[model samples]
Target chain A: MREIAAVFLSTVRMNFRDRRSLIFMILFPIVLTLILGTALSSVSGSSDTAEKLDSRAALINQDHGAMAGRMEKFFRSPEIRKIVHTKTYRSLSTAKADLKKQKLDAIIVINKGFTQAVENGSSKKLDFITSGDMESSLIKNITQSYLQRINAYRAAAAFAPQPAAPLLADHALSINGKIPRSSDYYAVTMLIMIILYASAYGLNVVREMNLSPIGYRIRSLPVRQINYLIGKTLGQLATVFLQIIVLVTFFKFIYHANFGSNLPFIFLVCFLLGFIIILLSIALALLFSYKMADTILDLAIPVATFLAGGYVKLSILDTNPIAVALNSWLPNAVAQNLVFQNIYGGTGQTAAGGVLKLTLIALAILLLTIAALRRNNHADLSK
Target chain B: MIIEVNDLIKRYKDFLAIDHLNLTIGDGELFGLLGPNGAGKTTLVNAILGLTAVDHGTINVFGEALSTSERAIKKQIGLVPQDIAVYPELTAQENVTLFGKLFGLRGEALRKGVADALEFTGLTDIRNKKPSQFSGGMKRRLNIACAIVHKPRLIIMDEPTVGIDPQSRNYILESVKKLNDMHCTVIYISHYMEEVASICTRIAIVDKGRIIAKGTQEELGRLIEDDQVVSVGVTAPDYSIIEKLKRLPAVKDATVDGHTIRIVLSERKLNAVLDTFLEEDLTITKIETNTPTLEDVFLTLTGRALREGAQ
Candidate 1:
């Protein structure tokens, strides 16, 4: 035990003495968090401008009758007014140019004899034009719904229309419900990214195992292999814990990050998350050769973070079999959803279940890391 | 006995690093394992220290097997490696004290041990300085101090004088002598024949992973019968002089190169040859005689210099 403690102290001293590692481990994360947080905060305040939908369209009305007037009235409906800000263009060429320049999302053309054909019980063809690869899917869906409502109104007129005014009023006003802000989504993403970076710092402990002169000295001592490894692990855990405290405090007080009602619970969750990352880092240091550790971490961290839903919504995977399977098993994804749900006032067994599952996964990873270290110890002895 | 090795074999893949080697060192004996580089000296020392595993034999230290009972054996052994092993950040005293604590020494005892080791290695004035601030010699001294702070029963030094100034080398050599005098069993490994000759009571010459020769200085020196090496400056001696000296009953071999005549002769016949040279009226500008040193014996047996890698 004393030997282990000595080794631990020696490792700490060496790490503290190395100026570059000191700055990288202790100061770099805080700087990154502050920069990203401030940028995200500014973005959150600009949510209003981002929520306005563009609706500039070209109208070629060939149906010169009541139906054409009614269609124009439908476009000017109060419901559509809340959802889209529309502009009219006369020609397809001008409209194409505008759509190409991103001034319009699409163009709508009413074909010739459209109202005459509809009155004679014949189907009328309406043409819609859009620039290549524009975000026309949403416009397509809304247009289809509008045409369906018009068809229903026509059917009611034919059946025995009794006061279709209320139906028209309902169709005139667009549903103006607010979608979630992009900044909120980005903040969640940035938080997940910073946490992963913090976790990568734990890899520094593994790096110390190979680079530290103190580690070399310990290897030459009479100390048991297991004791020396335990000392290193404990020392690294302490470092990660300190880092977590600093990051948590900065996010809480400085950036006013809303982590939600269970502050203590959140802290516990983050601590366990950090602990598992540190253990994995140590295992990486032991399993891979030193020269390859950096490369491996570079490739692994980003992929793991992305798969854990750094940018995309986890619900996008409701129909994706692979994503669903991984979402249930991957700790980072689960922790991300749990923390976000907690902040958004989601309280239920499902949220708690996700947290529990993530905790269990972290525990399993830690156990695997310990087992790898033991195997490495035996190999060292034989060597 | 402080260390005993019996048929120790260490193989690295297909090549044998230490081959069926047997050795023993009594308590307080400053035994020297003298050999050229790659002669398995370091390998044998590492095996005894349990730093490397043995393939087919046993190593006993203080009457206990070192391979299986490493912790017990290592607690009583000190090693000053050829490389610098001290912490670059810590002062010499701190490094010494840290190592002492590992051996279960602390408080006043630890302080005294550090001070004594520094004093013994002649670094008392620089104890508070970090190893990075010291010269190569001072660092080497600190390496030794750290190893010996716990005062282990046996101390193993592997080429400790390598790549240092002569002053530091002499200091380290003197310190080793002092340690041996203080009743510590020392295992000195080096390729320098003179170092082995100066202080070793028993020297073993290892070559190609095996002990080619072993004995006291005189006993090994007697391996070659031609004990007298004579170099004479003859003021441009004629080629006939080499032929004439070769015919003489006392001369084993004689060669004439330019103005000098060099000869090896049996010790008993050295005087007779000198008398014959004088009688022949040769203009001998210089004459020097030397008994066969370890170098001569090394050359005689291996047909190569003992300091194979010396610069």
Candidate 2:
């Protein structure tokens, strides 16, 4: 036990002494999160203005009757007008040219037969043209809302019934009557990435085994192999734990990230996931031999992050077969999903199952690492 | 006995690295495993240290058989590898302390052990400096320091002076003697014949996975005829000069290369060859006769240079 403690403390001290490793593991994650988070939040908060909309869309109006005037007035309603600034174009060709130049998000064309088609109960096509994929979903939603309101007005006139304007209610799902903000998602993702990165760095402690001096010293000593490995793994866990704590504290105080009812639970999840990642890293390090441990870690961490839905939304995994497969097995994915679900009060059965799944995966990796170490021991002894 | 090896056999594929080797090293004996390269010196050391497994052998260290439980035996052993093995990233003191802990030393004991080892290696002043910042000699000394911190009862040094300045080599030699004097059983393994001759009390010369010779320096010296090496530096001579010198009965062999002639003669016939050479009017610019050394014994046994491996 004393020998193990000594090994653990020595590993920790060595890690702290390496400046590049400190920056790569502990500092880079926080810096990357701050840069990306601030940029995304600013973009999401900006309001759309007339100039912005004009640059994004082209409009053509051909309605001439009173009903057409009313429809146009409805399109000019503050809610719709605020989203898109319409421009009258003499021809569709000109609108298309601007769209081709990428100076517009879309071109809106209202045909001369639109009002006549509505009166005669015939459908008319509203053409929208754009070279960009952005704002397509928002444009579609607003167009549907406009058509619904117009249909309601027509029914009121035809039935001689007094009808009230359709009311838009805030029916978004909430957890305990409080909706989750974007910051919550950011915090969970950032925590997972940071913890994984830190663990990856700490896992490289095994690389010291390749040092002939260290190898000779250990081989010549009375320390057990299992005790040495456990000491190293414990040291890595300590490093990851400290990094997660600092990151979580920074998230709460500096970034103002929302931590829901299960803050301690989230931290626990992070710790467990960190342990899994550290074990996986150790297995990988042993598999490739300690000589290439750092290189494998460099390649594996980013790839693992990508598979865990680090850069993109987790929903995107549905369309990515590899990501879907990895997400099911990845400890980081499981832990992140669990934390996100807990924050949103989402009762996902899969989320509940993740805790057990990740723990088993971590155990499997640790077993594989021990097996690798044993094999290495035999090989060295043979040499 | 501190270490005993009985009928040890190590086979790699079809080649035997150690064959039917039997040896015993008593406690406090500064034993030397002397051999040229590829003589199984390292393999024997590795077997003793449990770093390599012997095919058919029984090794007992400190009364414990060489098995899993032999870890206790390791606590009494210190190994200074042929290669410089100190951690480049760690200071000399840290390296010592780390290895000391492995031997069950801790706290003030660990600290004092590290300091004592460093001071013994003449590296106490540079204890706080990393090996990367150290000179080659300093690094080699630190490597030895790390191995000896726990003051193991048995210390195994494998070619500890392979590549270093003369001063450092001398320092290491002195330290080895000091360790032996302090009652540590030292196993000094080296290819340098002179090094083994100077420090080893009982020397074993391994050749081709077998002990060709094992005895004190004088005992091994007596195996070969006490021939004296005679060299005479002269101006470039004709081929007949070498032919004529070879015909001298007192001269066992003669070779003339470049501007010098080398001759080996029995100690009793040294003056007879000198008189013959002078009477023959052979230009004797310079001549000197020296007693046989370990190199001569190795050459006499293997019929080749000491550095060449035995076939």
Candidate 3:
């Protein structure tokens, strides 16, 4: 027991002593908490009390196709007008000026031949311009989301043997009755990215014990292999858990980011997310060479975050039912949804489900790590 | 006996690492396992430590068979690996204390062991400094300190002075002698014959997974006891003259190192060797006849230089 604790304490001390690792694992998060926290606070600070804010958007229809006319009418309809103050612009120059002056949150220009392309089963691009703020970016995604629905309906209409007389029928996607403030979305996304990057902790600590000469010395001692592995895993967990605490506290005190009424639950969700990331790093360490583990962690975390809708709200995974089914089970996606649900007043069922998925993944990775270590006994003994 | 190996055989695929080997090391004896690189010295050490499984053999350390309980047997042995195995990120004191705790030393015993280890290695002044901040010699010393911190009954050092300066090398040799003086049995493995001859009371020469010879320095030196080695220093010695000297009836081997020519021959051929230099008109600065060294014994038996494997 004492030997295990000594291994654990030594691993922790060694990780802390590595200045390069400290910069990425601890200091980088704190600095990001300061820069991103302060920058996002200005965008989210003004509208804290309300669940939704009225955003102003401009529409420019330059298409001569039948589908383009229908899309223009949908933006001017009463349903979109209630949430977005829409204005029709005659030219692109005026819309650009309003966006520059912050008068417009976003501007959507439906390109010519959009309807023709949809009719012929070809692709056409839409030009989107925003004020470069989080709110404006959300507005831009919303506009693009509506365009996606029109294309889907067009495809459905073409599939029917009997063409409907009214090709420009009205279609809508359901909203959850409450839209989260853009600031809350910003805070949650940042937290998700930070938690996933917790893989750095495992990459450093495990590789030190497994690959370095210190490892051989430890193996020659009376210590068991299981005790050594357990010590290393716990050391990384402590480091990542401590990071989550600092980030959550920073968001709370500095940005006044609301995590709903249940603060402990919010903290618990973040902790689970860190645990999952650390387990992933351990599994990765077992799979790849020590020199390649860090590089893999560096590339995998950011790419995972991007796919889980960390950079944009209501991403492709949100609208595509098939994508939604696949991504919902991913650790990053599950954690992302959990943070959004907890802060946006979601029912406890979704949050519980997300926690369950994360817990299952952590446990699975833990088992695989143990198996990999056991299988690696002969190779390690030779060294 | 502190360690006994009987008919040990270890094979990796088709290659045999240790083949049907037998040896015994008595307690409190500085027994040396001498061999060139890839001569199964390390393989034998690993087998004795229970780190590797043998195909058909048994090893007993401290009256306990290694195949039985490894952890219990390992507690009584200390290993100083060939490589410097100290953690670069850990301080000298932390490295020692951690290893000490591995042997069940706790509380005051752990602290005292760590202090004594540092003082013994002459690294107490840099106790708090990390190995990365240390010189190469200092890191080597730290490696020894970590191994002996637990004060095991049997200590196995495998080429502990491979790449350090002479000062640090001497320090390590001195420490090994002192440990043996405390009745700690040591198995010193090295490719350098001089180091083995200097400290080890009993030496075993291993080659090709087998012990070809084993005894004290004087007993082993007697392998070539009939041959005489004569050292002759000449000015601007020509290579052809040394070749001619080797062709003499009494000359068994001749080597030229700069201006010195060493000839191995019978004592009766000393006058004949000197006459060759005179006939060749080479100036002789010095001449001396000496006894055979361990290197000579090794060369005579193995037909290869001890340092050949190093290249």
- As a TM-score, model 3 comes out at 0.77
Q: Report candidate 2's interface RMSD in Å.
A: 1.7
Cα lDDT tens digits for candidate 3, B196-267: 999999999998789989999988988779988888999888899878987898877777878998788844
- Winning model by lDDT: 3
Off by over 4 Å in 3: A30-83, A87-137, A140-191, A204-206, A255-263, A292-295, A311-314, A320-326, A347-349, A378-380, B232-263, B266-288
TM-scores of the models, in the given order?
A: 0.68, 0.74, 0.77
The full ranking of all candidates by TM-score, starting with the best, is: 3, 2, 1
True interface contacts retained by model 2? 0.77
What residue pairs are clashing in model 1? A78-A172, A78-A173, A79-A172, A79-A173, A79-A174, A80-A174
| Model 1's interface RMSD | 3.2
Report the C-alpha lDDT of model 3 over A37-94, residue by residue, as the tens digit.
4554455354541223367888888885787787777778786666677788988999
Q: What digit string (tens of lDDT, one per residue) describes model 2 on residues B1-311?
A: 98888999998888788989989888888888888888898889888988887889899888788685667788888999888886666788888888898889877988889889999998888888899898888888988998899998999999999889999999999999999999999999998988899998988888778887778889887876567677887765556666666677755566665777777665457666666666667687887776777776666565455576645
**Candidate 3 local lDDT, residue B162:** 87
- What's the lDDT for candidate 2? 0.71
Q: In candidate 2, which residue ranges exceed 4 Å CA deviation? A: A34-191, A194-206, A255-263, A291-298, A314-316, A342-352, B88-90, B106-112, B231-287, B303-311
- Top candidate on DockQ is 2
